[model samples]
Target: YYNAIMACGLDSQDALEIFRLCIYDKQFIDTATLKDSQMQLKGRAASGVVFVANAALSVASITGDMSVVSEVITDLSSIGAKMNSESIRHIVRALGNIGDCEMILALLICLRGQDFANDLM
Candidate 1:
């Protein structure tokens, strides 16, 4: 399911939105699904990481639990995913969706070091 969702191109955002609505209840999240998503995103590029993170953030938004989101971040960090400008945008939006102000601020700070503050302006 996670792979299929990630494979979606132009419809990815819409699919994720619908998935978020369907899984608004925490019961919809299970150990198997979480592992499946993790496996699908493991060793992927930064865009794939962002894709999976966006989905994870949607789940976090619904359940108000950061466990999955944290795991995704940890996996990405360990692998040092090659993030590009677009990847940063997706991650920021995901963090914002889940109201992760601390992470968002941290990301902004990192971007500032990369001289993207002007772009934000």
Candidate 2:
């Protein structure tokens, strides 16, 4: 279901539906299913991070959930720290969708040592 969302390039609403289903539907996704997803997410490149981060931020913004925002920020920070120039560029673009000022600030701070900051101004 999550893979379908990624493959189809669905909008946030669609992606959120899948995310909710993944979180709530006990019969749909088991422990191993979730662990596999987590592993895949951890191994994803910058583009994948951008997609997931964007979806997470969108969900947080719409729901006004700070916890979700924080989680997504953490994921973005972790992935962004390891990405190369092209990946960082995707992350920067996705950052624009994030509504939380604090998250944006944190992302900026994390990007300081990277070359992407030079291109920002």
Candidate 3:
């Protein structure tokens, strides 16, 4: 539910705070009082986290917000979270859109070993 909102390019302090909660505090869990183990599954809870990452990348690319992009990258890296190939594409496209040398270096270092050669070339 929350992921849906964020994926639509909704930028707000509340959204970022909740994103941090999901990444650092494991915010997503059983909403009801039952505390169902299945509902609280780590993978299930993290499903939205990936969506948020993808969405954030898209927003960063369009808005050219280096700080936002850096924050997302740092948050994902600190947690050892892996982005899907689509997210990588977004990062590459952002490099083209924003042309930030620092971001290029940081992302290349962060994504070391991933086959982004075709995109770079």
Weakest ten-residue segment in model 3 by summed lDDT: 29-38
- How many steric overlaps are in each model, in order? 0, 0, 0
Q: For candidate 2, lDDT tens digit of each residue in 1-121?
A: 5364454352545555555554455554355354545654322333333444455444445445445445545544643323344434434445555455566678778778656465563
Model 2 TM: 0.37
- Higher-scoring candidate on lDDT, 1 or 2: 1
Q: Look at candidate 1 and tell me the lDDT of residue 69.
A: 44
lDDT of 2: 0.48
Q: What C-alpha lDDT does candidate 3 achieve relative to the native structure?
A: 0.58
lDDT (CA) per prediction: 0.50, 0.48, 0.58
Number of clashes in model 2?
0
In candidate 3, what are the lDDT values of residues 9-121, reduced to their tens digit?
A: 73633444555666654444222213432343232233445556666766666656656667777887776655566566667666777677787778777767755433343
**lDDT, candidate 1, 1-121, per-residue tens:** 4454445444534445444443443444444355545664322333333444555444444444445445445544654443344445556665776688999888687677564344553
User: Rank by TM-score, descending?
Assistant: 3, 1, 2
Say which candidate scores most in TM-score: 3
